[model samples]
Target: MNINGLEKTKTFSFDRSHSAKVLFKRPDKFREIEDLSKHNRTLINTGSNLSYSPLGFYKDSISVKLKKFNRIIDFNLKKKEITVESGITLSQLLNFTLLYDLWIPQLPGYPFITIGGAIASDAHGKSCALHGTIKNSIKEMTIFHIKNGWLSLSEKENKEIYNLTIGGIGLTGTIVNVTLKLEEFKNKNFITYKTKVNSVNECISEITKKSKEKDSFVYSWNMAENLKSLGKGFVFQNKINDDNVENFKFIPEEKKNKFLPFLPIWNKLTLKTANWIFYYLNNSSNHFQEDDFTSVIFPFYGKEAYFKFFGKKGFYESQLLISENTIEDFFDEFKFIYKKFNPTISLFSVKNMRGTQEFLRFEGNKICVTFDFINNKKNILFMSELDKICVKLKIIPSIIKDSRLSKKIVEQCYPEYSRFRDLINNYDKKRIYKSEISQRLEI
Candidate 1:
């Protein structure tokens, strides 16, 4: 079926090479779990379709869109918990919760991402050092399996399946509903502070200090335009407002007139110019400021201009989590690779993270670095080389952000890879739930 007048077959990524047949299904479409379970064809669940990778794309499989499942089943103010359908977007959740002075602690940069997708990837936020991944906020979830029917998994009940599903990438089953723990807030404003760092080493040092200080939120951006000063950037620390304020504004909505349709040939030059301008503007305004928490949380949504950088070919994002012990070495090699390839990187961000104990987690207290580049053969080769370096350093790449990572790299980087495979095989014996990513990485 068509969505928003878009074709049933469509490309979901910035990369024009990948495309899939989309099937839109409402919540009531599936009268029972057995309808999907007993089907002969493979299925994959999708929501918002914001994934940078091919996790939601499958050429031979039917994709189940969860947009119609969006709803708020219940909210318990006393417990500060909300039960929402999996298709509900984070933006919707925030808007609803804000009215009650409640908040979801872990939110990604994009508000359009769905709660189910967030939980599937175990997506983290700038406040990860304090709250960990989205899995930390999930109280429980209801998943539909082909063989098991409907299962309610939680930390206390069906704990193994719950942990596996957190970062399972929707391979185990379809996430239908979720109960999330929320934080109570007096106001929606945030007290933000920014500090400039001269180098990658200094950035790491500053992030470590901020983590120790237990900052509510911490993240850094690399504003350098060239290899000579690749890590010269700013560190941001923010805290939730403690007192209620009059006339507190939510984050500003996006203006369509602010963006121009992207031209493929000009993408590289446009991004370079944009990055330089962004660096200049941010560097000049390195000062403390107070703003709405929504502003700080969803910065990317405010500007649609950055989307033009991908052009028609789209982009690939590599997010690596390097252990604190090997961070210096990783950065040294990273610089070498960046200088050697000089890929058309549109964005670079770094965040301090205390790794989770989950089986698929990027273990150890580490620094997470993300690089966004235009999709091309040369850039793909460079990313492959970077993957090799990560493997050598024992650092793990975020599978959710990766599209081209091979099974060998995954096996080498994640020690629990075999265990994960075994669990999926045992649980999804029919292999009914599938995706391009799961098929590629043999998840």
Candidate 2:
């Protein structure tokens, strides 16, 4: 259906967890965005249609997609910077940047996430300990609001809005264009060193030590379903080298995933079998890859079926960014919750993350652990218990990962939650721009 030459579509979150019919517009020109800003009180942007959580699509609300806004405005070789429109995908950006042996330091695992969406979500990568979130690469941006019009923001210019807009979840305004600070791609290679860990504590300890190595990524694939060896897993430390490696071709985006099941396919026994096979398969201690750039980016590009297996019931991802001091205590409660609920945890992983702990941003110097649970009453209730732990331990649960996260938990977790809300209210009093995240969190 078409309304006002704009498409009307039933938009579902990437995880199929939330759905809403929206008046969708793919506007290219800054004028169109500004004009929409003037008229629509309820507006938000959608990108790649790929966020796990709903990105502000209420009934009849206008959703602007920046597909046509993709363009490379400027590329300075010496400065290692590129100015691009918000619609440009990270894959596209890297294709262009890698031609000149330059790329964005903060690379998202998904290939098709737009520059705008990355900024809005403040997406973090596996190597956040080294480079932090996408906010670190953003040198400047031009955002449009009804009142502010087209305002250029940066650290030194409009610093407050810049900070807010980074993880603001698109409430601040429509981010039209962004100037990303790029890094020169030297001959850097990483060797994946896998070690068998006894428990979650061992994993965290190894990750902490591994993170100290410069330009390294650390993560653990835990067998959380096993009570006897809970959190027993392999710690993968990708340590870097300056040696040159043969370039591999970029993995193009796969066609629409056809395996979206009608019923959920993940269960404890099934997951346990799969996790066990994967765990011991890498008996070797080290993996040598040919090219860092090609292999490191877009880990999810070819693995769409993993998401589809959740089917209509969808899934819930609770990614907690908890401080080092509180993690030990938090895990005590975590184990109790796991034992009590015995929730169907399909997948579990942990990453060593280090970034700013600021208003509404999930990034922090903490142990970032994520769990994928089948969407059911038991799992849902289990997640609620985790939320309680988050509040008690001052952990920041990722708002972008879960659609059902409560505003009260958000308020309790983030110290500057009220401040972020107040800033948005003051910046755009009518709050013309809002997303699913903002409305849910009452931001």
Candidate 3:
């Protein structure tokens, strides 16, 4: 089953942040994964390797890429359910399910990420405030281990493993495939309203109010270009509708972000220009415009060039999930830091999240802020200070986003951190499944 595999001396992670010398494996079937685990060093099962964090591989360890496992196992239209290989990407699943007038309800901004990645990260989607994460749609998971061989995990079967596997950061085992209880979807168009706000508080207010609605997705872009207009940005309120409206004829094919190493485009000048242009463009747009599901779900599909803007040095994305009570202090402190650092943020957005927090999943009635900045001393220092502030506010920094997050910060942020560590340690005594994230966080 291990038809093809090659060792690589180094690999830059999908996030373009961390790179490491790794032992690599491309296994076609479950048996190969088991066999490799028996012989290799600590291993991590990799999907598309699209995660911002180095969730797929560790330095000098076995990284098993699971592309061949991509396949559709079964579909039940009557129940609006599907079973698919964990290696399958969200784009692949969406393309297939859309034809049948069905779709997965919860989908992250980037659709190139694999089903396994979504389940592993418990990633929140556009409907994050509504459904929480992909876990709510997942009915069952089939995982393989050196000792367990194959285990079907669900609420009714292998419940403990089921709980741990969701947002376990792939430290549990190799996720073979999954059965998702999907949704019947037909509203392909959304009436989107982009409103310009004068302050971060107003933008956050818009997102919070719109989040409670069933047929819409809401998010805010916080501008960090100026001290006076630091938190002033636009809030997008997209409301799904069955009404006929103009949209892109087809979803754009996912493509690799062409690296612009020689000519970086994310410096202070470009950041300011881009912000000025983007702010006006969206701000000047019609009060209401129709967009397709593709536009709403995969915001980065055709705009992957945004990533290329980071150049060879890459970028850092830090997101924290904190309660509304913390946002006032968080916003004030963040603005103060922005004024002090004056780092050019390539992208900054905030959204509303509501769900139960467990394990390491990012959830809760929280306002989540994401800041993407080019990798540099100033930006790194800014993020480092931000991390300290997060710890001070007891805000939960996204464990899967920030590559440099320390175990101490994680221990402080997540009250159940010890429980997660102990559970997985007891489950996998040898730690057969591992990644840079797991090792870095001392999981």
Candidate 4:
């Protein structure tokens, strides 16, 4: 309930809030679908605040916690599908899938996010250009609606509701569970390559070319100081291949027995300075290998303690997706804004995005630019400026990471906004399922 450097009422008289302490609130049953139909107050759906973007902002609504629903109902190996309760987190599912050599095709920056949370925002990641958004990996979903009871939706049946739920931001109804498509890997090793580039345009060209090869993952770092490596930080290009003794690095018995604490470090000034230093280093060539595909697929596979990274200030991130054709123009705009604001941005990352047919898919021949900033007044002001720029250019900003963007801008970013609004109205005429964002955006 507390955020950094700011003191505001956590609960207002017209608003409601609920917090579920872990372990104590684990329930063993599901209520009748109709029970979720109508609530007397507005609701805010939350899983984890891993979203530095806009995942958890609601007004005049009671907070709804889904952790009690975490469960794996069924899975079909032949069909490559798994049905899971909505509250299950990504880390849990990742661990579960390892037993079957299966993995979710799309993963976002953080692993603690819930399955329903990811679907709500249509989450994506570095390999999106090759695979697709999280929506593409969903086989189907079940939502508890006020008027419709429990409805199972897919692209084939109840397509509107399906599309609405995926990237729908949980406005249509409360998502109770999901059936996602799983992918099996060859258990091959991935050869990672780190490369440096000179500018954003050149980085885009490299990723576009590399992604055509079918097996590639690139993560680019944007330089905010040195002009030489201004757009180049590091690139991890991976390829599947046979793993031999020489191709692998072994962990000795002695090393395996030792335990060392991971020092928590990464602050606003430190991160910005690090980026500046890496820009000057201008050299990138690093490689590592995992013996099997499972370990590699869940790259950042661990519980996230992000507070350690940003310390007390926490961190905020804004992600924007623009058409491939606008790559140069977008960078040009960024360069101008970077010089004008000179805000303390800890890091900048870029990834290539492939198109998706989901109604709310943040896709196209787009390139995703994500910026991480410390939570502070100056940083928030800079984000407001960036939001204004994105709106002016008509670029669709990713709402998952940005916490400061106004709802009006959010409405402008998605073309299917009105349709989603209509769907929400059909189920919650009294606006029982409302959030600060929904009201501001008029959804």
Candidate 5:
């Protein structure tokens, strides 16, 4: 079968400088996992390459595209559970679930991301303090290994493999299907309030206070215009609007043409101007508004136009999860670095995170902060310095966001790295499932 001409092609957003030819495959063409198990070729499972990390791209290896397996295999309305193929996109899942008045409590900012990709990256959302990551909602999953045809994993069955694969970056095997528990809400509207804050400390305080509410989603954006108003930004708190029955009728489709196809080159001046404008817009008026689920949950959808700001080099995001005790110190150092380097940082966001799991998990109650900067040598060096500080403070950098992280940095950041690697080696002794990130990080 012709797999859409994917053979001998390159994965999307592959590093321009890296000349790696990837051989692609579609599982639907094969009747069973045993078909590929005998081969020694390195096989890397891939979904939509929505991750900023190079988890899906492989150099001169077989890339299995799971997109063709997209389907809703089963649904239990009473249990509010659905089993879906890994390749189903978030948008598709949401649409299907909304028809039954069900919702996935946690979702990333982007809707195009595939379910398998979300679970592998352990993607978090604005309400992570309450719902945790996507892994929390998954009841069970079916993963296919070269040696093991199909293994069933969950909190109770094959729990070790389950833990490893949740944030395992697809090293364990190719996730085939997932059974997820869905949440039910009376309405799909959110009463959103945007409050301007003067500093990162205030932002954290506001987020903490808002997160105390039973069902509130809170996040903050830090302005990067200038040192005079550094860390000044807006905090958004959104609660489910109980009174909006009409909004619950259906999830609104994403707005079209809301963002330009391409943004102009980003520079200090342009970014500062954009930051000022955004701050003014948020602070001017109408701090309170009612928004549909799409607007509240996937706020950044249909905003691919921002990619143009990074120019031809693209961008890199450094996301850190700092414990409550060390958050202030982390921000202090972050601000200092921001002032010293003055890189063209386009965005900064903050959210609350709680709880912990074993393997590649963010331990303790912490706050997640992310910074996006145009990729360049100077900014790369700046990020390296920041990583060193993170290592000292015991801050955990998100492997899903930072593609440039070295193997040493990952080892230092994740204390369980050794054990995680051992699990991978034992599971796939031949190293059949490998990616650029897996090899680069020595996973």
Candidate 6:
């Protein structure tokens, strides 16, 4: 399992870069290894290595890759179910589903992410208000257990493992394949409505009410002075309808590929000003764009290597999922922190969630605050300040986004932290399937 182009590897200098000792890639040939339960090895759970956590945080075992295990095992059209290998990407799955007029309703922003990673993270999409997160669409999954070998799980068989595997972060075992529930669609026609709001509170109320009234997708933007630029943007609500007569082929092909080449490093100075203008337009616009699935999400996707956009300095995002009961106060306090730290935040969005049962599953009526900042001394200091604020407010930073927060902070934020750790310990006591974040949190 040699990594590709190590000597020529494009170096990504994030806070955790110093910790990544091994960057292993999977072999193209299929080889079955012996029992891996004995060692305290931790498998790297990165689908595309887009994570920002430190390397040594998890078990210092050899990093394994499932990239070569690509194939669609089966699909039941009548039942609207598809089973695929773990290496298959979201983009590949979407293209396949489109051909058959079937789709996985909840799609993460990045198309390159693997189904297994999405499941482990329990990724949520813009349409989560209507369809919930990715965990909701899981009908069944097959994981390669160390002692038990390949075990199939669902709501029925091995229900405990199934529940854990849904958002277990690949700790229970290696997710070799997964079976997903599909949404049927004869025509990919959707109605989109965009409207700007004055304040974060106003946007939240409108989004919550509108999202509940219809099976729709919603997202909000902020444009204000300093870092407290709350709710100065628009709310986009989209719903699939059967009456649209436009042909899907009528849409124009996307000209630029690979995220418009990530704006030159020298242009980093202009990002803030440009983003502010974009935020203003988003908040001011009341018109909606008729677009396809790809245009609707991928263009603004967080993938395409966000670190490269930050010039010599990379970027770090600390996302938190606050409880619904404390959302108002959370936002109020977040605004205060934004003003206090005065960090250069690139993009900020808010969305409402229903709930989930995954061990560390981020759920409930709350808003996801994602802070993007350039990797620098100032940015690092800002992160530290944010950590102090989160601690004081009892805010639980997302595991997948920000691993900078200490284990104590995570324990306070997640009510199920002990339960999640206990579940992992009971199953993989040796801690073979671990990551830098897991190690830091001592999961």
What is the C-alpha local distance difference test score of each model?
0.77, 0.81, 0.82, 0.64, 0.80, 0.66
Model 2: lowest-lDDT 10 consecutive positions: 285-294
Higher-TM-score candidate among 3 and 6?
Answer: 3
Error of 4 at 287 (Å): 5.3
- Could you report the Cα RMSD, in angstroms, for every candidate shown? 2.9, 2.0, 2.3, 6.5, 2.6, 4.0
Q: lDDT by residue for model 6 over 69-173, one digit each (tens)?
A: 667999888899999987787877777777788888777776676787788778778877677788888988888766567789999899988888776766777
Q: Can you tell me which runs of candidate 4 are displaced by over 4 Å?
A: 1-27, 32-39, 54-59, 226-229, 244-269, 276-311, 357-360
Identify the candidate with maximal lDDT: 3
At residue 248, candidate 1 shows an lDDT of 46
* lDDT (10s digit) by residue, model 1, range 5-45: 22356647434436666553444555643465444568787
Candidate 5, which ten residues in sequence have the lowest lDDT sum? 10-19
Which of the two, 1 or 6, has more lDDT? 1
Better of 1 and 6 by TM-score: 1
Model 4's lDDT to the true fold?
A: 0.64
Best first by lDDT, ranked: 3, 2, 5, 1, 6, 4
**Pairs with backbone N, CA or C atoms under 3 Å apart (clashes), candidate 6:** 233-283
Model 6 bad stretches (over 4 Å): 1-19, 23-30, 33-42, 52-59, 224-229, 241-269, 280-286, 301-307, 388-394
Candidate 3 residue pairs in backbone clash: none
TM-score attained by model 6? 0.85
Question: Which 10 consecutive positions of candidate 4 have the poorest summed lDDT?
Answer: 13-22
Q: Write the residue-wise lDDT of candidate 5 on 113-208 in tens digits.
A: 889988888887888988888877999999988876689999999998999899888988889999999998657788999888998788889999
